[model samples]
Target: MRKILTPLLTILHRNTCFSVRLAAMALIATLPGATLAQGLFSPAITVNGDAITGYELEQRALLLRVLNAPGNTPELARKALIEDKLKLQAAKAAGIELTPEELKAGMDEFAGRANMSTDALLQALAQENISRQTLRDFVKVNLLWRNYVTARFGARARPTDAEVDRAMGRGGASGGIQVLLSEVIIPITPQTAAQVEALADRIAQVKGYDAFSAAATQYSASNSRADGGRLGWMPLTRLPAPLQSVILGLKKGEVTAPLALPNAVALFQMRGIRETGGSDPSYAKIDYASYLIPGGRSPEALATAQRIIDSTDTCDDLYGIAKDQPPQVLERNERAPRDIPRDVALELSKLDTDETSTALTRNNGQTLVLLMLCGRTAQSIAEASRDQIGNALIEQRLQSFSASQIEQLRADAQILER
Candidate 1:
């Protein structure tokens, strides 16, 4: 009887211990914030068996919004995360991993963009419920991917001298003169003409390319505002007849007197001049059109522009998009490169016939100018700097290769959305 009772007590104690452990787990599941944490940290999507949690998506969207990135925040965040996963996987496969020190340095560099120290940035993010880990993760992936691409593809990404020369607009048999010019175009209406002229006069008085660049950033209406108004070497023949004498007359670091335009006043700062060998036809005239959209850089406006880009293969297709709008909305004209406005010419330089640029803005950022390249009539030109040409070619090739590699990675990835 004593043996039976002892065995029974031991069995009861073991059963009680198991019951207590199960009860505690059930209590934890029902507790405040516990279930919420589980849901937030749970996998939202799986890329090649690796999970991207809901919390990560929320953090990324918040980060993009803070950084003023364009487009839909959530959608963009999701897309970015998917790409990040792919990049990270590739980096791992290449045996390229970011060290802890390297990650901290990357975090520091990112904080510097906001003029803050790493600790300060972390504190600021914490106040907004963004974890420091989120920033670290973002920087880590970017740094690793960039390093990986350079290491893996840098050797094959170099551009030849001939490619660079052509990119620099020196690909023809005839040699020509090219001028390196910085420009500022201030849009003016009748009511604001006096103010525009006064501003232009002040800018002209300010000496040096740096001063001119500051003025361009503060006041220029062109899309090249972000570039400090620097227009890389353009053939002298590409400029308008009226502006040719003005640009050539100015000494280096000197600004042009205000030149009046139909809707704006223009100023040019001569940076330098050079002659290149091998004459490619300098464009004597360009035929193009401009269509205006109401919101300058808004997502909706950009989406519409993208739709137009996708639907239209040539400049003629733009006429349909402009149908039922104002007549001036689709203005077509043939003008020399210089007469086309420096910003417009810069955009045109990047495009082939029938291509379009959504780079320029007007009416002080309230309007988007869709510039369509209709055609270019080329004239004979001189040879350009082979070194400069080579550098430009190499840069372009690297960019193209980087993009192609990323697309290929995406194609090969096995992504599963949870």
Candidate 2:
């Protein structure tokens, strides 16, 4: 694999820039000799009698590395190939096939994620010894599996109006509060701990929107820092329980004292708070868990998260998984939506109870957060209409069904690794 990379770059020299060529050259230099000695096209693994070649693994790993995907690249590549095999097999069994237009669109959409055209993405991959077929196969499997899942389970997953009411707490008490707030989340590290802490203290003391927004622009690591930490009107019930009272007690333009979080310090400024009518309901509490896996977004960490998902059924199951590890490695908390970190909360919002996401990182991407939604305690008014909630419920249910179906396929399949 490593030997061929130089020639691959030679071919790409005319098309890719000098910097990309240098990076690819440097990347090839780091490949272990032992791995390069293997027959590149020989089977490394087999799923349900379908072979996964060493060439496939290498190409996929290179693609992931180019995309800056977290976790052990090789391991993640292996896992992905195994899953792709299963997905394709299942899709075939279900008689699911993609139209050429759908295939082209899938490829286009995938390239767009990297802010590139399909041809450009292919050229980039070619620089790293990855062929166009690798990308095509990956996109095809995903599209087929998605179509299969939607077709198989779409109808049965829709929620009734009563279920939506229950989910929204529609008939419960009204007059809940809503707030407009700004936020600042400063990162803390061992080297810069003292400096960041001092800065956070000073930022907490800042008064008026301009002062706070300036501080956020200068020091906040949050994505909202670009917009001066400004957040839209959110219901009080959406805030973490620990922060709700503190925020409510603040007058306009006053900021809260610095609050400690996992490897970060958070400060919120109260822009406005007001009582809301019955139409806008909110949650009382959201139960969730975060299990930390070291090595940031490396492939090994991602593979471990997948194994954990296979073994665990709920948040409680994480306790047992982390029993002998450090206490901080696993955390289960019930808080308001606004209290969770924006990234984690965003992932949580899309998930149903017991469902997990590995999209969040902490400690400067030095750790991966295996986040799971334990449950939600609904109360107050409402947001989505019955039809919208029904659609959401259907999507959520489909995710669960898709996961289960894949698990079943994996269990039944004969998977062998060399």
Candidate 3:
């Protein structure tokens, strides 16, 4: 299954654990000679009085590998199995039990996430030497824990009107985070990789806007380098989703750790951040194009880019410049913000409609990228309602309770690794 990369590369991969089944299968199904590792049936771990067999540990580790879960697979498998055992124990103590219909529904639901029937899923797993019981047990514990949480915390987790309004950005007041940032992007070719990495790390530690701005002016490969890499105040929602957390975590004047991007490294200094009046708008789609040119960041490539910039007024104009080139050299796409590649989204955030940037490269720095923003389709918030927002808040609160409950169980239970 681990060799299944090529055929399944086009299938959508959901990052969350529950939704990754199809993607995981896609990853594992293509392996030509892969075989499961077997182990003795002695206990590998114990939670309270329940034993986790060595065979079960191996099964889970294989599953985690298929899912491409990060870190040591065996360790992660052990931790997860321990948590599941605790969760089931807590569910049992709370008198949670599923009917046959409910268990079937849970199995169907889990299989549905991968667009497979329960039988189909079981057959697929069987082909990989994973038992049907393993799938049933995994689904059973999750269902039990969910029922336990809902029964115990549902009533206490309801949100008030004010809380709902605040969450949905309709609090009848201007609210949402906005940030001012200074950036430094250093191109990293194999020849300059070590130097660029060291430079980026050093820049990350530079204190104050002036110092950071100086570094940007001296070394940044971005257009904003001329303005000391200063960006105007931007709504947090307008940034790439991954970058939002990094920005939120910074204090004014603190820099983010050097973020790796295609052919470059980026560092940002937080100039200022504040809660601004107004809802932070979401976009339904972003339309953009990228034209690849030969000779990355070389004098000729830069001159060509500048010439193209002067001649082109919109994304459509790029078609003329790339008229004779291979189709793959030029790309135009309209994607939901969440679906855009992180590096592309980051660059798009810094542009207005029809604006172009040459800040990115491709083909391992052998080609320069000419990127243009076509336009953004703003997502309508007309359907957002009090009830929808309130229910979401309640779910969040319940999840918090669920996490704490598990922690309490783990603390009170005797868990030992054999």
Candidate 4:
């Protein structure tokens, strides 16, 4: 089966500068073992008869390496190029093409991320053997894909004002307490119900958030599994009345006993609880750390992650494990929830200080990601700017819709990887 590179696409879309850097590097990186001219046009992979050349793969790998994108760069490059081919094919089929002016504008927009003009970016790329045409082509495909997705999915993707308000925790007229929750939902069929129940019982006894998160990654069927079952902040009243009481009873850092549903077993972890005077009760800041594990989501890799989780209690404890690893392997930062990747943010939302999740993967599923929440700072609704809240809500919805669209595309396409 062809492995989808959806994660790589997510990374690239979230960090446009990283994609641009890859574009420049893909154009510049020299080929080995063959003459540059020959290698430049040689097929590395083909999607629906469209070839992604070896040169393109090399350039993407070089660029990903340069930007410190995690996992196996060459493999990631191959997958990324394959997906790009698919996107390009889809866009062409949909009659979506970027005009010359539109393409130029896209390039300018990309260059602006680094505070450079198109010519300046091109000059920089040329210094490293990349061509201006390469950058233009990169921008052109992305522009076309963006236009296509928006045109096709925009109505469905659009968030109602009430939906945005609910996301911002302002849907209700009356004030209420808000809680930060991390949730895992394990799906079950009639055949798996008993087995799932047993597993849920075991998860209930897991020692920490890290263990819970690992379980979620391995066994959960929810979209939140990508971030280890994190649900971020929402009003207490927003929850189902029965679950609200159960959640309110959980102490900070406590995971609930599995609550059986019609088709799934659900659990929640209480990261925090706070009261607010106004409608919004969202967090203002979050501090966390991510430690990269080499293998993706394989059982062996998961076992290794379990070991890491068992060996540590706090983000600081990870320092001992990271003693000889590259500095980039461990990252600690304080960011707004909106500034953090959606997956990571959700995981962090399910954690108390020092709790970790092993739910996310990187580099086309060649690496495991361990994310630990270090702290969260809450702001009163009065202090939180409406614009910031609204913008954040819109971005989150857009990200969810974009991911869904890509997944649907991959599902419907007849992709052949070489």
Tens digits of lDDT, candidate 1, 121-216: 788767655688887877788788778877887778776543443444434446567789888878766677788889989998998788899999
Please report the TM-score between candidate 4 and the true structure: 0.44
User: For residues 44-104, what per-residue lDDT tens digits would candidate 4 score against the true structure?
Assistant: 5667677877667656554454345666555556656666766788788898877778887
TM-score of 1: 0.43
Model 2 regions more than 4 Å off: 1-38, 170-385
- Best lDDT goes to which candidate? 3
lDDT of 2 by residue, 275-310 (tens): 776644557567899999998667898899889999
Kindly indicate the candidate among 1 and 2 with the higher lDDT.
2
Per-candidate Cα lDDT values, in order, are 0.70, 0.73, 0.78, 0.67
Q: Against the hidden true structure, what lDDT does model 1 obtain?
A: 0.70
TM-score of each: 0.43, 0.43, 0.50, 0.44
Of candidates 4 and 2, the better by lDDT: 2
Query: What lDDT does model 3 reach?
Result: 0.78
Best by TM-score: 3
Model 3 segments beyond 4 Å from truth?
A: 1-175, 381-418
- Report the backbone clash tally of model 2: 13
